[model samples]
Target: MNTQDPLSIGIVGLGNIGRYHAEQLTSLMGSFDIELSGGMDIAPTARDRFESSFGVPTYEDHEKLYETVDSVIITTPNRYHEEYAVSALESDINVLIEKPIAHTIESADRVATAAAASDGVCMIGFHNRFASPVQVLKQYQQQARFGDVHHIEAKYIRRRGVPGRGTWFTEEAASGGGALIDIGAHAIDLALYILDFPQVTEVSGVTRSIFGGRPDYTHLEMWGRSGEGPFNVDDSASAFIRCADGSTISLDVAWAANRPPNNEFVVQGNDAGARLDLSDGDLTIFESSSAGAPHFSDSEVRTRDDDPHRIEQQRFIQASRASEAPTVNTVEQALTVQRVMDATYRSNERGRAVKIDSEPLPTVD
Candidate 1:
């Protein structure tokens, strides 16, 4: 495939996420050199919907779609992530895999190892890092304007946004650990990214199945039909993470809670601090100036609401074109996130803070 030609992109798992990628890629067609080669899914309804909605070919299996694309995006359930991602990397096809890396640490390692060895580029989908607010905040941190950033408070809670019962999201075996692995992945990645991926030392966490597991749980205008099937996964979680650099993170995420929705992230630094909404991209910076009288200052900065998904897709195309691994949002970073999650679960089980191993993460050469 010539780099000059548009990159042929295929999507596995034509569900809501796959369709979302299709929408973002279409918007990028006029700007970036990309072509939606096709999509693959086993479900007839999903395939039919994707084919009709995007006017693209849909496949029942990956092999057929693999032949026509230069790159692939895997948006399948957590457990199936390794299957598609590893296969695509083995084929020397560039890959953009959605987060949590895989369902478990073992599975995530397999994906990371494959990404390290493969000739093709592999970038993890930690799209929130591309949001305007995060991008701007990262610039300030990079410039040393925020001094030594030491802590972050990340929140991504929903008032009553739990998925319907019996869906793959509600299944422990399929979705991994529920809210922790779902939204928690985003919060962890953003916090670490803001801190420049320092070595994690330990994690203390508590997970609760509070609302979703009950047969008597009230729907009250929540997602999908409530009280239908088994709900064994957690609905909310809280965790604290410590890093080798002495930086820290407090994570709070949920699919369903009694309080109103919250999507805020606060980064605390020695000289300055920053705050942003994870979903809305609103940003505010905090600092104290002693130019005249000693006083504190808070300034709000607004930026173009460029869709993070679209920016992520654009970067993936650039990586695929160069056949080089992305410098940021690498599979290695995603694996680190998986490690934190694994430790958090262990911490919950042991009722104590879990120490993370100091082993080096796999890196692409």
Candidate 2:
């Protein structure tokens, strides 16, 4: 890794995640072997803040920022991800678009198309795929420790937590669905990836905005906004998913709920079961058998909280230099997650099991 090779990095969108990446770039200046060429944000105040904090060049125009950098990270809102990603890729700059590539499948397709048309690199930020616990689970599952996974149950419930009250997050069009699209998307991606991305057969679910207009719902404020703003999105969602191999996944997500637990998931198979609790930082496995007394067991390895985002960024850099495909590259792979999301929304609308397009979209070169 040569520091003088001008591996210039540009950051689009100066939100929390964007700022985190910017700080990472600043911290990795010595060892990571890269340059923070510049950064862009639509808000001038944000740009000013970024420049003041990091002493990096700031551009109000993203295009100008793109012209000066070799690679760009799109951390904008969901609606604008495709716009900035496509723009950067068209400029022959490698790009790493944040999760939920776009609000719509069509936009995700366009971003992939632009990347394929050019020789530039493009990858979606599915960071959890890089976490150590997740990687370990994947390895064990690959070794068939669970003896053929038959079912998975996941719950990402929070005790009264909802993001920026009146901001773009609560808006349906800008951020897509509320709870399901936000936290549920991560859970969905994790489960699907672990399941070897089983072919989704059918999806049925319901979504509700239990306290969208309730002023009393003030105990948990995710975005740190006041209650006067409209919260016209689903606060909770539940879905029943059927895989092509006859396996099932019971998924539930709630940004705000009066539950005793925070966030947890259980992956079960004939031979064993494992519990993953993000808040507690634990991934415990339970070995069992139908012939003996039901029991629990734990692997002797310690779980280290690996910084998934940093690992994801490093992988992008490696892939860019090596001209290799990332673990989760292709728009079609992303669409697999999107299909479940779309079906969930449709099922909520129709109150019935909706069929999914099992056939993946054409792969991009």
Give each prediction's root-mean-square deviation over alpha carbons: 1.5, 2.5
The CA-based lDDT of model 2 is what?
0.79
lDDT tens digits by residue: candidate 1, 1-365: 78678899999999888999999999889998889989999899999999999999999989889999999999998999999999999999999998878999999999889988899899989999998888999999999988999899999998777876668888888888789998899999999999999999999999998877766766567543444446778889999999998999999999888888999999899899988986677899999998899999999989998899999999999989988789989887898899999998999999999999998888786
Q: After superposition, how far is residue 172 of candidate 2 from its true place, in Å?
A: 1.2
> Measured by TM-score, how close is model 2 to the native structure?
0.92
What shift in Å separates residue 235 of candidate 2 from its native position after superposition?
Answer: 1.4
Best candidate, lDDT: 1
Worst 10 residues of 1 by lDDT: 220-229
Report the lDDT of model 1 for residue 20: 94
Find the candidate with the highest TM-score and give its number: 1
Error of 1 at 46 (Å): 0.5
Query: Which residue pairs clash in candidate 1?
Result: none
Models 1 onward score TM values of 0.96, 0.92
